[model samples]
Target: MRLRNKPWAKEEMSKYPHIVIPNPKECKGNWNKVFGNNQPIYVEVGTGKGQFLSGMGKLYPNINFIGIEKYDSVLVTALERIKETKQENVKFLNEDVENLLEFFADNEIERLFINFTDPWPKKRHEKRRLTSEGFLRLYEQVLKPGGDIHFKTDNQGLFEYSLHSFSKYGMILNNVSLDLHQSDIEGNVMTEYEEKFSKKNMRIYRCEAVYRD
Candidate 1:
């Protein structure tokens, strides 16, 4: 989906410095200070529209939720949603996922979420996949030992590829589901994309993969 540019997005984001962290890199390793607590941080890599992040924050009040999105226009909507939810534990970073390490210290994050991310289906672009070996290495570097990656996607190809990628990286896979909505899993938080896909009766694949200690 082509993102429509919101002319007011930048100004709107600036007004919410506490929620839309302007200088995320400066908070590196001191994220707990940013949230004013030492709660474990759970990061969502492509936190589009903030639905999942805000929802997760509402459910897990003791955990800090940070969403990373590169586009300001897209992130502004998420910021609004978080504000409406009145969730103080959730925050947004208008930054790219590639710079994850720059804003986080080793073992800073307790878990990671990759919800309905771009499939990058072309075989040549496999490296760009969030679950690809290269990205997994980045996740490993910043994640605490035993930190797990929770992934969900509607694309079967990406799901299959991710399973193989995680296996190849020697990560342990658990709670793998070919059809998430149809599964018995409880407490599922839906993203904007996930809700749309599920309404269309599309199968949603989900899994949790953890790095070995």
Candidate 2:
């Protein structure tokens, strides 16, 4: 994705100190302390423009939601949304998921959401896929034992690849849905991309994967 450079993006993000955590690396394992609560912590990798995370913070006030987006330009949009809503339980991280350990300790996160992450379809780029074993290993290190991953994607090739990857990595899959919009599940929050694709009559695949001892 070619990110448009927003010269004032970083400056704008700094204005929302409550939403955009300052020096997130310092919070590290002490995330509960950052939120001032022991409630479960949930993070959305590749949060995009923050539609999902923002809605989740409102839906589950008890759960702390962090939006991780590598590009400042894209993240600033999320921060602005949070700023407008004045949502207290949400935070934003402008960094790559590869360095997740640098800001969070083992068992620090209770749940993770990978919503419409890039497919990275090339065979040589398999490792770049978030559901790949390489990324799953990283998730295992930071997520608490038995922590779950809620993943949704519209790409069939990526969805199939993720199912096999999760199975190979020994993750227990549940709530599998080949066409989420047609499913009977309740409380399904739609992302910007999800709304756009669903309008096109696209099938949205979704599942939950858990780490078991």
Predicted model with the maximum lDDT: 1
- Tell me model 2's lDDT, rounded to 2 decimals: 0.91
With candidate 1 superimposed using the best TM-score fit, by how many Å does residue 65's alpha carbon deviate from the native? 0.2
lDDT of 2 at 144: 93
The prediction achieving the highest TM-score against the true structure is 1
Q: What lDDT score belongs to each candidate, Candidate 1 first? A: 0.94, 0.91
Estimate the lDDT of model 1: 0.94
Q: Model 1: how far is 36 from its true place, Å?
A: 0.5
Flag regions of model 1 displaced more than 4 Å.
Answer: none
Per-residue C-alpha lDDT of model 2 across residues 1-213, encoded as one tens digit per residue: 678999899898887777788788999989888888989999999999999998998999999999889989999988878878988899998889998989899999999999999999999999899999989999999999999999999999999999999999899999999999999878898888999999999999999999985
